[model samples]
Structures are given as C-alpha cells and as structure tokens.
Target: MAYQVLARKYRPQRFSDVAGQEHVTRTLLNALAQGRIAHGYIFSGHRGIGKTTIARILAMALNCRTAIGTEQRPTPEPCGVCESCTEIRAGNAVDVIEIDAATNRGIDEIRELRDAARYSPARDRYKIYILDEAHQITDAAFNALLKTLEEPPDHVIFMMATTQPEDFPQTIRSRCQHFSFHAVRFEEILTQLRTIAVEEDVIAEDAALALLAEAGDGSMRDALSIMDQAIASAPLDNGKARLDAEQIRELMGSVPNTVFERLMEAISENQSAPVIEEINRLINAGNSPSQLARQFVRYLRNALMARIAGENSELLQISPDERARAARSAMLFSEEDLTRFLQVMLRTFDELNYRQEQRFHLELGLLKLVHLQRLLPVEELLSQLPAPTAGKGSLGGGPLPGTLPRLQAAPAPARPAAPAQSPARPAAPARTEAPIAEPTRPAFSPFEADRDRKITSEATTPAAASAAPPAPQALTPIETAARAAETRATEATRTTETRATEKMQPAAVVGVAEPIAEGALALAAEADTAPEAAAGGSLDLDRIREAICAALEREGHNTATALLDAGDWKQSNGAIEVTLAIKKTMLALTMNAEADKICRNTLKQLGVGEKLVFLPGEASSAAAAARPRAAASGSVQAAAMENPLVRQAQELFRAEVRTVLDLRDRK
Candidate 1:
C-alpha cells in the first residue's frame, strides 16, 4: 500500500472523533438512539471541515451488526471492529454506495440511482447512498431524485453532501434533514497538530505547530497536510526531526514577528532610511513584496485588535508574549494612525500585482506611512495654543507710541506779575489772581517750557533784537527804576510783535488752542474730584486701551482682543474712535457691541467719559455722493498704479488705468 498522508491516515472514523460541529454530531446521535432517523440527509459546510467524514460515520452507525447487550437494533456509536463498520471505513461496503456527483451528474445517472433505491439492501440492515458535491448534479437529475428523496424506502438512506447547500433547489432541500457545519477553531486545530506531532515522534516546537495551525486558516485538513509537509522537509539534527518557527518561516517565505516589530518602530519614529533598508533586505532574502505587504496588513490588524479589545480578544490568535509585544507596539500609535496604515497597506496589496516595479511601489507606500502626520485630538491641539489675556478692551486707551508717533503738548502762555502800587494811584483795585483750575491736559514741565521758549525766541528774533537783551548789572535806586521801566517798554514791544504774528496765523493758533483748552478743563475737573488725578495717577487714553483689552480677555472674548490689537485708536474732541478692517461684518458687529459695553464700564471706573465709537472702513452712500467724482476717480487710479506688478503690466501693455475694484466692496 502506498504510504498514507496524515490527513488520510488519521481520518475521523467515529462521530466522537470529530472536533467542532457538535451540533451536527449530537443531533445525529440522538436521532439514532430514539430510532427517529430521517430517510434523506444533507450535510453542508466549507471544505476540510468534516462534512463527508461525518456522513461516513453516520452510514457505518446505521448498518452495524454488533449489538450493545443483545439489543436487536443498530446503535448510535458504531462498533469499529464489526464487518459493516470496517467495510464502511475502508470504502468497500457492499450495501453502501458513495458516488462522486461531479462525474455522475446527469438525469440518466440520477435515474439509475433512483431505480436502485427501489430495491432492498443486499446484506446490511440498510442500504446507504452518499453523493458528494451533490450541487453539481444537473437540474433534471435533482428533479428525478426528488420523488425518491422525499419518500425513500425504510431499508434505504440517502445522504447528500455539498459545500454550497444554497445551489440545491428548495423542493429537494425541504425533503432532507439539513446539518450545517462551521470552520474549526484555532485551539482545536493546534491541539490536533500537537497530538499528531507527539504520536508521529516528530520533534516539533509548540510555536511551530501554532504557526502551522494559523497558516491553515480554520481548516483541519489543511493543517494536517501542512504538518506532514513540514515533517518531511524539516532538516534532521542528531538523527531527530527538528522543526521551528524560523525553518517554517523560510519554507513559507514569511518574515518573523520581530521583523514586523522593527518595521513598526521605524515607521513610528518617522525614520524613512531604516524602512527602506528593511524592505530591501526582505526583498533580497527572497520575500515577495506583495506577500510582505499582506503579512504587514495582518500584523497591523492584530495590533489594532489588541488595542481595541485588550490582550485577551479571541480575534488575536497569537501567543501571550506576542500579544504583549503587540500591545506595546500599539501604544506607539493612535487608533487613527493604525487604521490609516492598514488602509494604505491593503490598497498597496491590491495594486502590487499590477505594478511593474513592485519594490518601488512598496517603498513609496511605506515611505508615505513613515511621514504620516501624528493623529492628535482637536481639543488637545487647541490646548497648546496661547490663551487670550482676560478682561481687556483694545479701545478706551490713547494711541500707543510704539504704533504711532507721540503727540507733543503745546506750551501755555505765561502771565506777567502786577507792579507794586505807590500811594499815589490809590491802589488801583488790588490785582485779583484768577483761581487755578485743575489741569485736564497733561502739563509741560517747567524745564520743557523754558527750553521751548528759548527755542522760539532764537528762531524768531532778528540779530539786532537779540543783541539788545543784555541788562545793567549794578544800579542805584533811580537807575534800578529806570532799568525796570526800560525792560517793561521792551517787553511791550515784543508783546506787540507776537500779537501781530498770532493774528496772521489765526488758523494754526486757534486749532492748536481749542483742544488744549478742553483737555486742560477735563484735567482740572478730574484733579478737583480726586487728589490722585492731580498726582498724575489718573488713567490716560493709552491706559484705558490697555485696560479694555485686559477686560475683554478676562471675559473669554479673545476674538475681539485680537482684532483690536491691530486696530488704530484716536481721540478727537472727547470722542474715542476705534478703526479696524472689517473682514467679517457680523463678527465686527459683535465685537464692536461687546467692546463698547466693556469700554464704557472701564472708562467709568477710570473717571473717563463713555464716548467710544467704531469707525466703518467704507464711506457711507451719502459721503460718497458728496465727494467730487473726478477726485475719487483720480484717487482710485493712483492706488491701482501704486502696485508694482500692476504698473509693470500697464507699462508692458501700454494701458491706461481703468476702474479700480475693491474685492471687499463686493457682496
């Protein structure tokens, strides 16, 4: 006899020997014990999952003659040594007929079997007909067997098996007892392999058997076949068969888990060089790029499952050590990153076969994975940005010197002292001193005022007028009186000259004096109310702007503060103006409203008036109408021509400036 492979040599001979599919086995055993066996039976499942084997066991149980304690009936558990059982196991039972439906699939063949079904058993208690791949039978053949299948003789049993049960017509399926099978579990497959290894005296490691079982992909037959191949091809050491994971990997053209770990680490670290080198090494070692991609996809899937389902997920078929390693690798990536990596590899696997340069494509895909952005939650990213300063308004303060030039305060006019009265003029109404008003405007220091006066006199006086300013050093009483009289006469002359100049420059003088007067009055009122204001502790325009910004930030109105930070602030006639570009109209409105309220409250607290105003970027319709058309057009053209690129294009094309359009003006 030819040497039998492990699959055939260890074929399940009894119902109890079958692993998994307990549903089918238990139902069949119960039916036999209660003598409730059906006339027709159908077994359906994936290949190598014990469909045909179960059918054979059922047949032997039906025909066995060896009784259990002289009961004159067949038993659920067949006596293997009995002639009927031995013959069925050997596939030579006279009463049992196993037909390959793939070859005998026509109506004529089914008709012949249907005719044979009418007769009684030749020897055994019952005649059994088992058809494999029963779905392959033609429609006409299924129709011919329908009547016989529906009501088979009591002494005959019809057993049909197919991997695809749905292909059979409903009319035929309804008449048979259907038993569905499922793929065997990993543990069952692994246990079976270990038992075979020990029984065969093959020196195989448990890890090697586990790998073989995983490679089987839920098929016991495939597992046994792979084990047989490994045992034969395994190199002998000290006259003993030796098999390990490395040898299995070499035979299967697979990379070890360690290789996958190394690749994952390199990708997480964004090291493209090591990734490229690893790929080259694998390719040089005879590993197919497409195969490696598929294995990597599997590895990532395992790691992802471990992350989501913990280390004890049934989906993860790896060992505890491998699970721990996978869990550690999973910690290096977020779920989004792992998912993206899987997607890229799976897509590359699909395209790998079509590409002419497989290695190039693989390298490109892996490189993309290496440079993929780290996945961070939106909340976390937002937390890293600088937070806005609280409770501050951008307006309310005066202009910042850093942003704009400083304004110089004009000097106040000095008052001359009254002359001492002699008894002769009868005390021309004792000179009354005007009450000093609190200074609203910032006052110029005496040093600054004196410096300005000197500068003014130097710039305005003629050489003759300047030279006559020397006074007599020592004098008698008459001389002192004469000197004072002469000095008064000269001052009167200078005053006459200044008044004439002031009249000539009335516009400049008036414009400068009005604001100074208003500021002075305000400062005096503030000083009278609070002594601190007199001491220069009162808040100024700049301080008000800073305080408003601080207030806005405290209220979580960061948007308003940011907009105001780049704004222009001005104070004219006691009114404060805040000018900002209106990029978003609604946002501008909201910010203005909030800022107005905050500015009012802050100014009230600082003893300032609540006169805040928002300046619109575009002129109103009435204002535009009031402007001269020619001047507006000229301004627009000037702005357009100011851009270098626009000017170059105009010169190149010898074009005149047409209408200038503002994109922001459009709806």
Candidate 2:
C-alpha cells in the first residue's frame, strides 16, 4: 500500500473508538441493539470532528450481514469480519453508497438519488446512502428529496453529515434524526496523539506532543494531520523520527506563547526600550509583524481571562505551563488594566491586516500599553482628597455640603523634574525630561495675606479678636484650618460683591473698594442705590424703593417685589424695613433668612446694605412713620449709570452695560 496519512490510517473504526462524542455514540448503540433503526439520520458539528466518519460507521453497522439477526450478534457494534461490513469499510459495497453533496447538490442529482433509494438492497439487507457536506445542497434539491427522505423504502436508509445544521431546510431536517457532535477536547486529543506517536514509533517529547494537541484546537482529525506533517519533517535519530516542541512550532510557523509572555512582562513593567528591542529582535528573526500582533492578541486575551477567572478556571484554555505564565502576567495589572491592554492589542492586530507600516504600528501599540499603565482612575483621584467634617461648617455655621474639602494653595517649592522613567519601573527608561520650574512664592497673595490682616484689623478690640478667633470657643488644627478657610471664602464672596457694586457705579462715586460690611454698610439705602444720595449727593426715598424693587425683579424675586412694593419701604441707619400686608405666620415664612435670600441679593446689587427685616401690616401711609419721598424719573438702567462712579467709568473707559446674566442659579 502507498504511504497513508495518519488522519485516514487511525480513523475511528467503531463507536467506542471515537473520542469526545459519547453522547452521540451511546444513543446510536442503544438504538441499534433494540433494532429501532431510523430511515434517515443527520450529523452536524465543527469541521474535522467525526461528522462524516460517524455517518460511514452507521452505514456499516446497518448493513453488516452477521449483525442483521439480533440473535447472532452479541453487541450492537458491526462485526468487521463479515463480507458486507468488510466491503462497506473499504468503500466499495454494492448497497452502501457515499455521496459528496458539494458536487451533486442540484435537483437533478437529488431526484436520481431518490429514485435509487426506492430499489431493494443488491447485496446487504439494507441499501444505505450517505451524504457528506449536506449543508451544501440547494433548497430546491432538499425540497425535491423531502418526500422520499420522509418515507423511504423499508430496506433503504439515508445518512447525512454537515457542519451547519441550520443551513438545511426545516422540511428536510424534520424528517431526519440529528446527532450534533462536539469538538474533541484537549485531554482527548492529547491522549490520541500520544497513542499515535507510540504506534508510529516516533520519538516525540512530551512538550512536543502537548504543543501539537493545543495547536489542534479541539479537532482530532486536524491534530492527526498536523502530527503527520510534523513527523515527515522530524529529524531522524538512528531509525526513528525525533520530534521537539521548537521543531514543531517552526514547522507550524507559530511563535511559542513564551515569546508573547516575555513581551507582556516588558509591557507590565512599562519598559519601552525592552518592548521595542524585543519587537526588533523578533522581526529580525523572521517573525511577521502581523503574525506577532495576532499572537500577542491571543496572549493578552488569555491574561485578561486569567485575571477575571483565576488561572485554574476553565476559561483559560491553554496548557498548564501557559496558564501559570498567564497567571504571573495577570498579577502585574488590574482587571481593568488588562482589559485595556487586550483592547489595544486586538486593534493593533486588526490594523496590521491592511497597514503598510506593520512594524511601526506594532511598536507604537506596545508603547501605548506602557503609557496606559500610568493612568489613574477618577475614583482614585477623588479618594486622595480629605473627607468632609460632620456637624457645623469649619467656621461654626451651617454645614458645608460637597464631595471635596476646601483646598489651600500654599507656596510649593518648584520641584526639579525627575529623570524620565516608566511609572511601573521607576528606575528604567532614563530618557531626558524637561525640568519643571519651581512655583514662585510671593510675600503675600493679593487676596489671602492682605485679606487676613484686613479681617484682623476690623475687630472692635484687638485683644478680644486675637485671644479667641472663634466666636464660641478655641478650635483644634482641623477646626482652626477650617475657620481660616471659611474666612478666605467669605472674603472672596464680599470682594465679588464689591466688584459688582463698582461696575454699577462709575469712578466718580466712592464705589465699594472694600468689603460691604466694613464701611460701605454704614451708608443709608438711598445713598447706596441712587447715586444722588451718596455721602453729599441727593436721592429721594421713592427712588430708593424703585431701585430696590427693580433689583429684586432682576434677582428673580418677583413675589417678594410685588408684595413688598404694596407695602411702604423705609430706610433708617442702613436697614430697610418692609411692613407687608399678610398674616404673621405668612410673614415669617416669606421673610426668613433663607426665603429672603433673594431680597438680600437684590439689596447687595443696588449697593444697599444686606440687612433686611419683614413686619406684618397694611401698605396705607398710616402704617409707618413718615419719611421724605420723591417720584423717580428715567429708567432703572439710566439711574444706575447716573451714579457718579458709573458715569466716571463710562467716560474714562468708554464702556456700557451691554447685557446682564443671572449667575446665581449655578452658584
């Protein structure tokens, strides 16, 4: 006989000889023993797994002469020594016919087969027809043979094998029994390869055989085919062929996963130079950039799987050595980090498919892995901030609500730029980095030190203020720091109000260059609103009320403005009192500090003092003491610009208030 490939030589001869298909085999054996043979059968599954082989075995069993009578044959298996079984096994039986559906897939061919299946068996007890690649049959052909397949002759049997059971029409498949096959597993393939090696007298190392089994990827026929090729290329030792893992890998054009694991180690360490050097060396050794990228994607996928499901989990489908190596690499990264690395490599593999500069893109992808390892998640950054203190504000007021603490910007020394190195490998890379200039520390900040001193000087008594800064009691460092921060925050707020006041006024009037509470608050309401009421200027009580009402409307306090406008507004000692026309309960709800926030903000905008008081009464003139009043003229904007300070600004800077935006919503 001519030299036969191992795939055909060691093909399964009986149901028990097949590996990893006990489900299909056990059912077939029971059916045969009971003589409950089906007229038609379909086997479907992955390529190179015994779909077609099992179909042939079934044909032999059905036609075996000695096994026809259940009394003669002790087992359901075919007696290979019988004339009918021998002829069927050799593929020349008169009644057992095997058809390749890929070639004869037309309606004409199916019609011919249907006509032939009607006839009685020529030699064996049953006429069996086997169809391989049955999925290739056209819909018309399947329709043509549907009736014949559904109701074949008593002596006729049909068997079909396919990889895609879904491709067959439901009509054709419904008339047949489908035996779905599973891929042969790793251990089964490994055991088969070992048995084959020993039978062939090939001296294969254990690692070499393990590599062949993994490369098979769960297909017994594929593994045997590869082994046949490996043996052909194996070097001779005395008389037997000697196989090594490296020799098999070279023959298969595969880079051992060890190379990829080394690359992963370089990436986890963030060693750019090593990653680049390794790629250069691999390419120099004749590894294609695309192939290397493809291999790396597989390696990264395994590592990510190992990170998520432990190394021993079935999710990592690899040899024991590879699993251990994957676990080691997985330890170097978080699950998220491994996920990102895998994503980058998968994209790189796809790019290498059509990219002109494969090597360059591959190297850039590896460097990206090194860079991605340096990223810090937002949650981690937020975690580094100080936690909020419970109870009162740092300055002992209402609680401060937010995720972050108040940050203090101290004068930090300019840090000399450290030498360039990978974050994962603190000592490597050694590339030159630009020096970071030290931050300049001024003697005093325009807002901080000066403002603190100004606050200290505003005290009624220096000893009273210096002895105890807190109103209630002395505080710890946390509390004291909180108080100082609160003071700075308050200073910033007052400074903002002063700037707004100055904008409404011009340079001629004394615009609030200081905080309103300092000295600006001492002025009467008319002096603050109507520029004519400044220290020596003249402004009427009615004009002050109009200005305050207009300001309230601008601040979105329409209800307050309408109600307060109905009442008489009087200004005395910088305090504006509004005696509203409502019940006492309604009075408190409408005028509490929180509810009256709009009124306070409006007063501030008109440059009036922030103090406001609400009383319940009617708006008739008899409800309050008399105060001089004047009917105001001109629009509110015109009056604002009429301020001496505002007119001065317009004249000096040639500016005008083009538009105004309410920013309190965001605040």
Candidate 3:
C-alpha cells in the first residue's frame, strides 16, 4: 500500500476527533439536531487547519443513515459502520460529491453542478456538494452558481470551503452561512503531538515533543508531519522508535542554550564581533535566515519580559536555561538599550525576506545596535542644542507641561555636539571660551538674554521709541521679562493677523497697504450700529442686545422680544449691561465671551450700538448690603479664570489684559 501522508492519515473523521474546533463542531451538531440546517454553507480558515476536513465531515453527517436517536432528532455525528459512512470513508460517497474548485473553476463545471443540483440524491438522504478552495472559482462560475446557492433544492446542500474568505464574492458569501476556524493553540497542538507520539510507540522526551509542537505553529496537520519526520530520523539502535533531546535539537537546527547565552553576553557588552560569529555559526549549522530572524525576535521579546518582571524564568516560553541567561544579560543593559536592539533586529528580520544581501543586512543591523548607546533620548537631544534666542511664539506650550526641568545650555566649551553619554563613557568636552558649570542655572529661558539686550538697546538707542519698552522706573526685572514676552507674542500675533487681512482684503484696497477708506467706512457703519465700537477697535454691548432681540424676534421668540424692548442698558469704564427680568448669574456666566464679541461686531456692522446692560430687575435681597457690583465682577472674573479654553489661550498666546467690555450700554 502507498504510504499515506500524515495530513490525510490523521485527518479528523468525526466532530469529536477534530482538535481545537469545539465551538464550530458544537454549533453544527446542535443545528443538525434541531433541523435548523441551511441549504448553503461556507467554511473559512487558514491553511492546514481543517477547512476541507470539516466540510467533508459535515457532508458525511448530512448523508449518514445509522442515526443515533435523541430526545429531539439525530445528532450531526455519523456512525462509522453505516453504508453512507463507509462510502464517504472510501471517497466514493454517491450523494456527497467533492469538487476541487481550484483546478475545475470554470463556468461549464458550475453549470453542470447547477443542473445536477436540481435532481434528487442518488442514494443517501441528502445530496451534498463540497467545493474545496471555493475562492479559486472564476467570477463567471460564481455568478452561474449564485442562484442555486441562494435557493437550492430541499435535499441539496452546498458546503464551500476556502482558506481566503475575503477573496470570495460578497454576494456568494451572503447567500451562505459562514464559519471561521482559528489556528490551534500551542497547548492543544502539544497535547495532540504527545498523543500521536505515544500511539506511535516513540520514546520522546517532553522537551522533544514541545520542540515539535513549537515547530508545528498551531496546526495539527503540521504537527503530525513534523512528528513523522522526527520518527523517521529517530535512532533505532534497540529496534525502538525512541527520540532524545539531542536528536530533536540536531534535527531542528536550534542553537543550543550555550550559544544563545554567549550571544546574550555579547549584546549586553555591546560587542559586535561575538554576535557576528554566532550568526555565522548558525548559518553554517543550516539555520535558515527566516528561522534566525524569528529566533532573534523571540529572544528579544523574552529578554524584555524577563527584564520587566524581575522574577524567575518560568514566565518566558523559552527553555529555563535560556530564560536564566536572558535574565542575566538583561541586567547588563538598560531598557533603552534593549529597545534599540529589538528595533534593529525587527528591521533586519523584515529585510531578510526581501533583500538579496541577507548577511550584510543582518550584520549592519548588529553593528548599528553595537553603537546604539550613542543615540540620546529625545529630551536630552533637544536640551543639548542652544535653544533659538526667543523663537516665534508656539501655538501650544513648548513640549509637554510639567516635563523634566529645562537644562541650561552648558558653557560652549563643555557642551559637545552629543549629549552627556552613558555615565561610564563621558563624551569629550568641546573647546570654548568659558568654563562649563555643572548646569546650576534654574530653567534658563533663551528669551531672557534677548530681552535684556533689547531693554539695554532701547534704553540707550532711539530706534525703538515706537516699539516702546515700558519705562524702566515702573517695572521690576520679572515683570519686565513678562512684559517683554507679552509684547513679543502680541507683535507676532499682529504680524500674522496683518498677513491674513492682506490675503482676504480686496486687491484695490490691498494696494493701498492699510485700506484706510474701507476701514473708515466700516468704522462709521459700526459706530452707527454699535456706538461703543468707537471706544476701541471693535463693538461694545448695546448693539449686541438689539441684534439678539432682532434675531430672537425673527425666530418668533416673543418673551425675548418683550424683555429686550423693556431692558435698560448702561455703559461704564469698559463694560455695558442690559437689564433682565430675572437674575441667573450662573447662566449668564456660562456665555462664551469670544462668541459675545463676534456677535457684538456683527451687530455693529448693522449700524447698532451702545452696550447690552443686563440689570437684575429682581435684585437679590442681599444686593445692597453685600455690594452686588463687586460680587458680579468677581463672578465674571471667576468664570473667565475657570474656562479651560480661555485660560489656555491666555497663557499660550501671553494675551495681556487690555480691557474688559460689558455687553450693556445705552445710545
């Protein structure tokens, strides 16, 4: 008899025999017992995970005769002694027609199947069509079979299996019930391999069996195939099929724990020579490039895990000796160093699959890692450079808030191009005019020096009279610094605003540079609409009340209309108010000040102004005794202070307190 391949010989004959597919098997069995059988079905999974095998078993179940009587109906499991089961086992089941869709994927084949699907079963209870690799079928064939799949004969069932479900047409998929099988777990694969080894009477060590399991990569068919290879290669000195760890390791071409330890030691010392030697040894020992890459990635991963936990080696999947070696090696380097090595290994591993110069790529990766300690952390890198002297204002605050204290730029002599290296290897100091201190200055703002120069230059020279450094007599150093920063930020803001206005302004006005005529017309219209706009560059309060009234009235808001009509507005130093029937300070406080500004400006364009004075008609009983004005001002200040967006904008842009405008005023 011809030798049967392990894949076919160990093929799961029943649902119970199928490994690592309990959920799928149980669902199908229950469906069959409940008579909830669908006419068309699709089975999907990765290669060698039993997509075809499951489809075949499902076919056998559908056509099974010697049914086990249950409380409701017969279950999905078919009795092996039945004629239907015998025929299926022999691959000559009359009712269960198996088709290899890959080779026979034509419209003609599908048409013939479609024609045959209409007929009753030849002998069994159900006519089953099993198409393996159904995704390989041509588009024309799929289109031809779609109608039959959607509404097949009562006795005809289509079981289509494919490794690539995504490749199948959506229409065909929608017409069938779908089931996806996942890769078997490592434990499950190990259990199955052990059972097979025992059944084959091969004396295999647990470690040897585990090695075979790992080599299988979560596939039973793969596990069996690997086991067969091991069995064939096993020593038969005593006419016994016994396998030892040494034989398994030799056959697997796995680097021994000693070699791995040596490599680990080299990595920890940042020595490239020993690492290269190990790679060469592995290559000479017949380790495939892909396998070597996988091993390196695995080692890096295990090393990281071992480093983090600071415990025993049992947690890692690698051998106990390897884990111990990794733990020791992990102690030799920092997390950052290990991270760099992992990144290099990953890049090299990815390149191995595509690049012709595998050794060069791998060696280069190793060499780069050997020198990885030279690279500094991001913060260190930035702090090493002399920060630009008061660079343009950043949108968000520089770096993260509450980050590490800013490092003072070392005196040019001691500050080399590179940052302070690992303590063991201090960088050579640069030649400079000044002796470097041990970074004692607290948070040096590069802006401080520039601001000081600007101040001295302004105090002595007359060029900056218009720019106007505030009088030196009035301000302290810190206040002066704050003021300078604010002035610079404001000037930067004004420049950007000017550019934006230039872009948006009409060509004729743009040529005039300032657009004075348009500004005058806008100013006039604004003053007419919102009289308070004349006070500053923008609108004040009264116009906003009138605009709100108009808008609310247009929207059929009568209450708002009456309130606005009767409301009295008053204007003060920089604020305005409109009297309201009720006093809800909290509600009023919630109004966005920026949105109010936009509304006020918009109303000013319509020739409306004054200020929106909201007088509390029903004054609180404590108003006179407690000072309502002070309380109200405090509330508004508190509201602005609590606003995250406002606070962020104020701090980020260094906006100065110019004036606070109230939304109430009378014309």
Model 1 Cα displacement at 196 (Å)? 1.2
Task: Write the residue-wise lDDT of candidate 1 on 173-257 in tens digits.
Answer: 9998899998888889988988988888788987898889888888899989988888888999787788898888888888888
Across 1-667, the per-residue lDDT of candidate 3 in tens digits comes to 9998666777788888888888899999998788899988899887778877888788777777766585322556876667888789789988899999998999999999999988998888899999998999999999999888888889999998988899899999999999999887767777787787776677888878777776677677887887888889998857778877778778877755566567767755557888898889788778776777777777777677788876364356544455677787677666766777788899889989999978778777777766665444555435644554311222243422212222111112211111122323322232211122244332233333323422233356666765765743433333443343334334333443454555543211100011121111011112343334436435434445556655543434433443444455455533344444432221122122322344345455665443333443532323322321211235332454455865686687874221122333435
Predicted model with the maximum TM-score? 2
What lDDT is obtained when candidate 3 is compared to the true structure? 0.61
RMSD of 3: 19.9
Worst 10-residue lDDT window, candidate 3: 510-519
Error of 1 at 125 (Å): 2.7
Clash tally, candidates in order: 27, 9, 29
Q: How do these models rank on lDDT, best leading?
A: 2, 1, 3
Model 2, runs deviating above 4 Å: 68-72, 377-667
- The local lDDT score (0 to 100) that residue 530 gets in candidate 3 is 31
| Candidate 2, RMSD to the unseen true structure | 17.1
Candidate 1 achieves a global lDDT of: 0.67
Q: How high is the CA lDDT of each candidate model?
A: 0.67, 0.67, 0.61
